[model samples]
Every structure is written in C-alpha cells, then in structure tokens.
Target chain A: MFFIKKNWLTGYITIVVKGAHPELFFQILAKHQIMSWNIIKHDKETACGRIKLADVMKVRQIRRKTRYKLSFGSRKGLPFTMKQLNQKRPLIIGFLVVIIFIFMLSNLIWRVDITGLDAEIEEKVSQQLEEYGVKTGNFQWNVTSPGNIQKQLLADIPELLWVGVKRTGSAYHLEGVEKTIVEKEEPTPPGHLVATKEGVVANLFISKGQPMVQTNDVVYPGDILVSGFLHSSDEEDTNSGTIVGAEGEVFAEVWYKSEVTVPMEQELQLMKGINEKKHYLQFKDIVLPIWNFKQPSFSEYQIESEEKDFYFLKWKLPVTYTKKTIYQTEITKQQMEAEQARKIALAQARRELSRTTPPKTKIIDEKVLHESAENGKVKLTLYYSVLENIATKQPISQGD
Target chain B: MKKNKLKESIMRSITQIFDLPSEVTLKLPRITTIGTIHAYIENHQGLIIFSSEELLLKVHQGHVRIKGKGFVLKMMIAQDILLEGEISGIYYEK
Candidate 1:
C-alpha cells in the first residue's frame, strides 16, 4: 500500500540492468535505502526491476561504483499522466468551452407556447411577451417571474379573464381563458309590474300581465300598473285566482330638469403630436439612463412612464427597466359670446340627462326655461320630457 | 574463536530464558513460507545470486539457497526480501 501511494505521487520507473550478476545491483540499491520491487532475472546478464523516481539520482551514483549498465524503461503514475495532458492544451480548452456553452443554452428561453386561446389573442399575447423581453432566445434572467407575467397579461389584454404562465426548463407555457360576454336570463317569479317613476302612462304592451292603469292615467312611484292576479279585487273568490309572473313594457312620460354653467373664456391644453422617448435601467435606488439622453425642448409637456422588473429564475432581482414618453403640448384660450355659451350649456345639460337615462328612452321635448350671463359665465336651466319604460317587477308574497 | 563461541552460547541462553526471538538476539535469518508459493526472509545480509529457478542469500553465519521455478523477487528492502514462486526446497550452506 505504501509503494502504491508513493508510485502514484512521485511516480515510478522500470529499469534494466545488464552485467554479470545484475541482481547484486538491486541488493546494493536496497541497502542504500532505495527500495525496488518486482525484480525479474531475464537472463544471466540482464535483470529488470521497478524503483521509485526519487531514487534515480542515488541509483546513478551507485552505477559509478558498479560495472552494471542501467537503462530506464517504461514510466507510470500521476506526474507523467499530467505532463501528457498539459501537452494537449487545445483539447482541454475546447472541453471547457463546450461545457460553458451548454450551461448558457440551458438558461435561455427556447420556445414559447400559448394555449386555450384564439389565434388572434395568442398572437397578441406573444407580442406582449416580446415587449416584456420574454421572447424566444432571450436570457431567462432578463424576464420577470411567471406570476408577474400573468398579471401583466391579464391587465393588458381585456379579453382574457384568467391566464396562467408556467416556465418549464427552457420553455414558457401560457394557458388563458377568453372573456365571453353572456346575456343572463333571469327567472321571473309570479309578480306585478309597478311604476318606478312619477309619470303618466303613454303606452302599454303587456305580454303576460293584467293591466291596472289605462293610457294617459297618472301613476306615482311604487304604484302597481299591472297585477299578477287574474281576478279583480271586487271578485268574490279572489283567493281562487291563479298568480303569474308579469312580463310587459309600460311606456310613460318622464321629465328631467338640469342647471348648467359654462365659462365664456376657456383654456385648453392640446397635444402637438411631437414626443420624445427615454429609456433607463434602474438598480435598486440607482437609475442609469440607457437611451435618449437629450431632454425634450418643449416648455409644456406631459410624461408617461412605465417600469418593468427583471428576474432570475423564481427570484425578483432589484433591477427594473423604465420607458418614458414626453409629449409636447400647447395651451389655447378662447373668448365666447353669451349666446354661444348658452347653446353649449343647453347641449351639455341634454347630454347629462341622456347619460343618466336608460337605454331606448326617447327625448320627446326639450326647452331652456331660464338663461343668463354673469361674471364671464353663462348659466342655463333646462327641462326635458322623455318617454321611457316605467314597469318594474315586484314579486308576489303568499301573505300579501 | 573459543571466546566467540562462548559469547554466542551466552546470548542463546539469554534468549531462551527471556523468551526473546532468536532472529533479533542471535542475528539469524528468519524465513517464513506460505505453503509452496511465497517466502519472506528477514534479517538477511545481502543477495548472492538470483535466477529464474533459484535464489541465494547471505545470512548470519552461512548462505541460504532456495530452489524454485518461475522465481521472482516481489520486493526487496534493507533487511527483508519477499520471493514469490513455486518453491521446491531450501538448503543451508557454510
């Protein structure tokens, strides 16, 4: 065991000694504290033995005193093997380069797949990913985490209800569900149609209800215009009547009054469509501008900035990319006559009324009740009469 | 010669009485054989002759000769020699 350890560390060599009684040379070497092993006498004059490489100098000195001729044979062990490897430098370097290249390739995004979505939405999602620096061939460290990506996808694409982002090795997988607008059909119970506003009934289209009020009859809020009960109250057997859900439309005259004020002199800021874009890389609290070093020359401008985080694997790094767009704007002031201001105020009031009303409402008449101009402003009071549906479902209770 | 003989006898008596090893007290060669395949010799002076079928070593007062086939010296140190072969016989000579 000691010989094997020494042979591997310092190395060993086989030597052939040629002379009369060559074995005597090895005995002399042993006496000098230089151990030899595996001695074989090939012939009377030739013998071979293995000796440690460290004892070579001692053997040479002993050779001067003896007539035996010595020649070194095969060499073995770690030192020689290392020397041979050092001579082949290119092979070792090439092996290291291949290992590094493989490691880098493993950390890159090779493929991106989006599933459970339409082709249009899929393309939109991929484009959004590219904008976020998550495209194919991009380094995985430069892209944010899957959770952040999922959130960004949901926020940017309105058509997506829920989206899942998964990273598997060198690939990115996305599964999404599209938002489908579905109209709900509510189950209407046996009930009466009541008036939700104070108005006069202009028209009635009772599909499945008993009409309680006729046309041009005035009704108040909470008043039942249609009854779910088939029998009248004067009937002797009111409890025997069958109750049904009231489905109908009762058009009535609805009125609205509004007061609006408009400034005679108006100031507005308008965009000139000229803009500059700047990009920055932020590391913790330190921000470094990467592009668009020059500031915008416009005195009045608006800035819109967006920041994106960077990640390595599942960890969020303290680095972000910011993009800012500066838009040039101009302020303009205009003076208006009282008549023009009054017209604007009236139109504004009408718009407000229509916005607050339900769909399918018809504006039958509009009038400006009062108009005046003071302190560089025009104030107007307007009234509108609209024909709209006034029927509301009121479920019937057994106790009632 | 007579005095040397007397000293040798005293050393032998001391070894016997003290239960000491003869190889150390008397400067004698101790040869251990494992079946017929290997022979380990300790306290040997030097190698006298070696061949494919025989090995001879100088011991304390004489020479030790071993007759064998395919004889090879497995290892050789200052005071020990390990010889491996098919051993046939061993002989002592003055």
Candidate 2:
C-alpha cells in the first residue's frame, strides 16, 4: 500500500549529484528524513540516487547548506503521466466525445431482418410496416406498441391467421401466419359417359345411367358407353325418356408404346483431391485478399469457401476471415457393353410407362417388341397392355 | 573495553533465556540470498565499497564482503540494500 501510494501519488525522481564528498550528501539526506534509494557512486566525484518528487525543496535547502551540485534526471509514475495528459486537453475531450457517440449510436437499430415469408408477401409486409412508421434505421422509442402493431397487422391482412410482434433490445420482430383456403364444389350439368380412348371393354357397371355398350365390345374414342336418358316402360306414350347425368364404370384394355435409346459410349467426370487455397479478410462488405498472386490454371474446378466471423460476447463484429478452396475435376469417356445398354434402356422405358400410365391400372402384359443397334447406340421399343377405367362424362347440349 | 564485553555477554545470555532472535536482540544484520543471483541485506550501516566484480556492506559488528561478477546495487534505502549479481562467495571481516 505504501509503495503504490509513493509510485502513483507523490511520484519520484532520479537525481545526479556531482561534488566532492557525495557520501556526505546522502548522510545529510538521511538526516533530514528524506528517503532515498538506488544510490550508486559513479566515480570519486559523482553519484546518483532516487528521491521522492515532494522532497525536491528539501534538496534545495540542503544545497544551500552543503553547497552540493544536483541535477534531476527523469520523472516517473502515474501522476506525471496524468500531468502530461492534462497538457493535451482537446485530444482527451475529443476521445471522450467519440466514445459517448459510439455508445449512443449502438442503442439505436441499424438493421432489420424479416424471415419465414415468401418474397412477394415479404415485400407487401415491409410496405405495410413502412406505412406504420416502423422500419430499419428508425429509433426503437418512436415505434408503436408491439401489441397494437400485431392487432393492426391482423386487421389489415385478411389472409393472415395470426400475428406476433416482439421487441428485443433495438430490433423488432414481426411474424404472422397465413390462413389456408378451402375450395367449393360447383353443380355439374346432365351428361353421358363416353369413351376417352380406343380400347376393348373388359368390365362394365352402370349406377345412374343406361348401358349402351356391353362387355367384349370394341369402341373408339368419343363413343358413348352409357346413355344419360332413361326410357319408360310404356311404348305407346310419346316423350317417354328423361335426360339426366350419367355415372358408371367401364374397364377397358389400353396399350402403351414407348421407345428409348441409350448410347454405348458415355463420358464420366471425376474430381481429384488436388486443390488450391486462398485466404481473405472481410471487413464488413469489403474483401481484402492476401497471399493470392495468380488464378488457378484448372479449366474445370469447383470452388468452395468457409468463413468465420469475429464476435465479442453477444455482438457480432463485421469482420470475417474466409478461406477458399478450388478442387480440380477431370472428364473421361468410356465404352458401355451391349447388355448394360439394354438393361439401362429397359429401366428407363419402365419408368416412363409408369409415369404416363393412370393410377389404379392393372398390367395385363408387357414386352420389348423390337431392339436395334447402330452408331454406338441401342434402341428398344416397348409395349405395355393394361386394364383401366376409361369412362368419361360429357355434358348434353340444348339441341340434343 | 572489558566492561563493554561484559555487557555484550549479559545481553547474549538474556536473549538465549528468552528465545529472542539475535538479529533484533543483538542488532545483527539480516542477509538473504536467492540462488546467487540476488542478495538483500537489512540493518546495514553503509556502502563500504562497490564495483562490478565485488561489493562490501557495513553491518553492526563487522563488514560483509560479496565477491562475484557483474554485481549491481539494485536498490538502497537508509538501512536496506538489495544487490543483484552472480555471487561466488560471501564472508564477514571484523
């Protein structure tokens, strides 16, 4: 405690005393109760030592009594530094002002983030918030209450099912849920069941219409399979049939033909582990690259980068360090066997047939009708026979 | 001189009977060393001689002579002196 007080408050000074009998000078200093330390004799005539800055006046009084020559060297300690700073008052004031300005600015919002919405809906929401005077770069104190904003948002957008507004520090968060719409069914006019494609009838079931075609009958597209009109039992009466909508199920055999060709020779691309690296410093949006003199010579390569951001506590600094790596790739051609090509074509043909075929179809038969090879390519033509419902409703016209 | 010797013997016997430290009871100099690199002497009278190769300190009864190379008087107060150097030997001369 005493050492700290001596070092920072009263401070200290080194003094060089040049005179005959310098030892006597130290004796006089000790006699006067002035503390001195680090006393060293330079030669027969000169000596140096340290004394407290407060004892400089005592040294002057002793100089008159003993007539010794004394000169001070350097001044030390925290007090002396503070005195030096006192001389440059304007610089200190400017530094303090800058610190206060930074503190004040940090208490205001600088960026606004909105997520969990589509681009068009996000734009609309942003525009709506702008009308409410809530936007980026705006002070948090000027914004309306979060509850009021949430209520207003729910009222303005009819499609929204719920809304939430939360404020954390200087950032305001607004989120909403959109309502799901349900579709209604429209009344269908009276119609008849017609054949949508040419097929051989395999099964028929009439529910609300008269059957026109029976099983094992071959019909073309646009042919009526079920008549919507019901005939009365009384044959002598005129206008005996009543028109209505047709409803029935007619199963038929439909054929699918698909042709696919696969090349015997193909190219393969492979990536080697050979890569080049570059490092850069990201200050905000600006990138300053280092140690990167030339671009990589690889014609085909993939670029991958990793970035790490600097942060202090909960605040993320705008500075980031990024490392980019470029991996080399090579492409080579190879020959495929005939059997391999045939297997690939068959798989692709089956995938296409399944994609085009309607749901709930029962496959009756499937075969590769023809196969041909020319110009390093193999082609296969496939046929698929299936039984599926082919009945479709056609509305009756006024003239009919 | 005979009377002073008798007084010293009396003081020594009294200190031994009371188990008092000699540095306080007899005004003896206290010397501490740290692996030959540093030496601190308390209750020292004055600097007898100082040099890069050797240093001598005046104590209560005799003088302590420190023989070493690169000797420096690191700190000095009224009765305390701190010396730093490669100490080779230390002895008292009456």
Candidate 3:
C-alpha cells in the first residue's frame, strides 16, 4: 500500500494483502475511515505500512515480505558549480562586459610632430604645427584612427615638410620638421687654386683658398693659380681632415675689363599734362590689359598697387595698376648743338657702361671711340668700362 | 558630468579587482522621512533580486558567504538562506 502526506483524515491508501483473502482486507479498510481503494499483486509476510489494511483484502497463496517505497517527481541534487551560479547570478552578468578602455583614455595626444623643417632656417617648425591640425584636445573628434588621420592630412597638404603622428593613452602626439633647402655651405677648409690657362698673370684677386700664382708670373695649364690644398697647424704631419675639416679644389673664371661697345638711339619718354588710369588682367604668361595703343599720351610712369593669390600651390596670379603720363615725340630738321650732342653722347656712354657692370658698382670713365651721321642724326660711339673688385677670397684661419 | 562618469568607471574596476560583495547605492531626494537608500539589488541577468536592511558578504577561500538582516531574495533562488527575523529572507521559493 502507498501512504500520502501526514494526515490520516485525508489521502487514499493502496493496500496489498495475502493469505487468499483480498476482499476481506478491503471490507475492513472500508469499515474504518478510508478515502479511496486500489489493490495490486502482493505476497506479504513481514508487516509494512499497508500491512494493517491487508487483513480485509484476501488473495490465494500469499508469502514472503514486501514493503512500499514512496517518491515524488523525478531525481534531486545538481552540480555544485551550477548551484553556486544560481545563487550569485549577478557575478555571471559581470563576466560578460566588453570594455573599450582604450577609447576612455584618448583625451591626451600621442606624439607631437613637425615635418619639412630646417634647424637654422628662418621659419620655425613648432609655429607651423600650431597653425596646422596639431594641438591638444584636437584628437578627440577624430573619427578615423589618429595615425591614419595625421598621415592623410600631411599627404593632402604640400605646405608641410614632413609629418610624424603617434599617440599615447590619453594623448595624440605629433613630431616633425619643416622642409628647407640648403644654400650657403661651409668654408673650403684648406685647398689650392690652380691656373686655367698658359699665360702670364696680369692680375690676381683671391676670393677663397690660396693663390699659387702672382702678377706677371708665367703659369701653365693644369698649374696651380690658387691652392685647393688646405691644412691645420696641428695637422702639419699630414694633410688629412681627421685633424681638421675638409678642403677641396674649386676653380672659377677670373678676368680684367676690356673695351666693349653697343650702338643705341636714346628714346627719352617726355611726359605732358595728360594722364589716364590703366588696368591689366593677367593669369599666367598671358597678359590682358585695358590699354592697347603702343604710343602713349604721356610717359611718366608710376605704380599704384599690386595683389597676388596662390591657388593649390601651383598657380600664382597677380593684379597690378600702373599710372603713366603720356607725351608725343616731334622729329624735325634741327642741327646737333655741341652741348646737346655732348650731353647725349655722355648719357649714351653711361647706359653702355652700365649694361656690362655689376649692380652695386659705378662707371669709372668714358671716352669717344668713333662718331658718324645716321638718318640725319649725329650718332656717337663710345668706349666705356666699370672698375670693381668682385673676386671672392676666404683666407685660412689666422687663429688669433 | 564626464569626469563623474570616469570616476565611477574607475571605481567599478577597483571593486571588481578586489571582489566587492554588494554595492549600497543611494540617491537623496529634496526631502526624506523614509529610508534614503534603496535596498533592492539586481543579480544574474535580472532573474534574481535582493533587498536587505543590513547585508554582510565576505569572500573567503573562493566561497561566497552572504549574511544579512531583513533579506528578501527573489527569482532563481539557488541557495537556501537561514533567516532569523520577523521579515522574509526569500520572496519566491520556486
């Protein structure tokens, strides 16, 4: 028989009885307070929980001891790990968190950078960076990778000399130099100047290194006019730069002035009172202007203002205004007065002299070489030359 | 406000490193007569809930020992809590 709960007033009992009297045991269970009844196969000897009800139910040939086992649902007991998770469920939730800690610490710039710069150049690299995209807190808004953004910015712009972009935690860093070309160079340490031709030295002006020839000295080709060889006092034992700086041979043209003449008709632009404003539009090599007539109303010229714009680092366009006084030339039958001819000749000589002269030098003298009449006008030919010392000489250190 | 969030995240990492038991968080209203701190805490995918007056939790030798007063545990009850109070320690048995 099966037992349920702990109350006797409720619950049905399944009774099993032996001794060939199953109906008799059922009758006795019904006489007492019983809820329900169900009888199954049984051979009872020992007393069990349902053995008290077996006296009423009777069956034939009942024997050995049999007992009832009570159970509910299925099995119990689970894995200890599973049980712990069920208890502390919050811990499992915490385990699955994906952290972008790297983004969190991206406030500071990584590498401070400059590119295309020179050490002693007039323009500073650091100044360029401030003007460009390199600055603090500027990295926060970058949608792309910081390094990639820096590279693209530099590649797209030509003003930058070089670029180096990097980052550290909260900081994005930039490092680079501004671009500059080298022009001036170091001294030609110690060297000798050699002769370029086979001739007597008429004049020697030393610009750099040592002059190996003197005035009136006969020199041959491949001979030393100036020394390219140099040395330091401490390097007396040998001519190597290990004890000093480098010195090498270099040769340049040296010359004295000879008479040269060019015939020219002076056209002096004389200005009258009339004046007009002229405007010009020029993009590149092409010139477009409002003025067309080659003959001007006046010739006194003055520049007003000029403006320029550079686009894409390629095209540079300029706009300029020029004001000029206009005048007319009258060619008439007039004899050349001595004073006027002499003045005109002197001015012509001055122009001829200046053409071959250096910018900072002055004409020393002028003399008439020849004179002739051309097209009813007196033309004077003159011999003129300028005197100036343009020789470059860099002496060895006197070491005072 | 951003600085406050950063500080809060830093505190979270610190707590995880040291394995803190439960965080007692509170927001103060303009005026208060009832208890200021909300005792309810969520756990395990919000499948379980916990509310207690005084919670004592310590991790020793990898075993989590949870002790508290006026504890009310709910949903996915894994461990049986021994309670000694007039209040309920577990709200749902199933």
Most DockQ-accurate candidate:
1
Model 3 agreement with the true structure over A262-323: per-residue lDDT tens digits: 23344454433445555455555665665654544433443333332222122222533333
Docking class of 1: medium
Residue B1 lDDT (model 2) = 86
Proportion of native contacts present in model 1: 0.87
Tens-place lDDT digits, model 3, residues B2-92: 9977876776677777776434221111111123221232221111112233223211111222334443321111122222223323222
Note the clash tally of each candidate. 0, 0, 77
Candidate 2 segments whose C-alpha is farther than 4 A from its true place: A1-5, A20-24, A40-45, A113-134, A140-159, A162-177, A180-400, B51-53, B69-74
Q: Sort candidate 2 into its docking category.
A: incorrect
Best TM-score among the predictions, by candidate number: 1
- lDDT (tens digit, per residue) of candidate 2 on A1-400: 3663665577888888888866557656765777776666677677787888888998889888876799999888777888899999999999999876665565465555566666776677778887776787765445556787778878887767787888665577767666767675554567889998889999998887788898889989999999887776466542467777888789999888889999999898889989999888989889998767568889988888877544333365687678789899888787989899999998898777667766767888889899998999999998988898899999888585
lDDT (C-alpha) at residue A263 in model 3: 32
Candidate 1 local lDDT, A1-400, one digit each (tens): 5766777788899999999999999999988988998899999999999998888999999999999999999998889989999999799999989867876676688899899999999999999999998899998767877989999999999999999999877789999999988877766789999999999899999988789999999999999999888886688985689888998999999888889999999998999999999999999999999998997899999998877654454455588788899999999998999988888887888788879877878999998898888999998888889999989999999786
TM-score of 3: 0.25
Candidate 1: chain B TM-score equals 0.97
Off by over 4 Å in 1: A119-124, A127-133, A140-169, A182-400, B16-22, B30-39, B65-69, B84-94
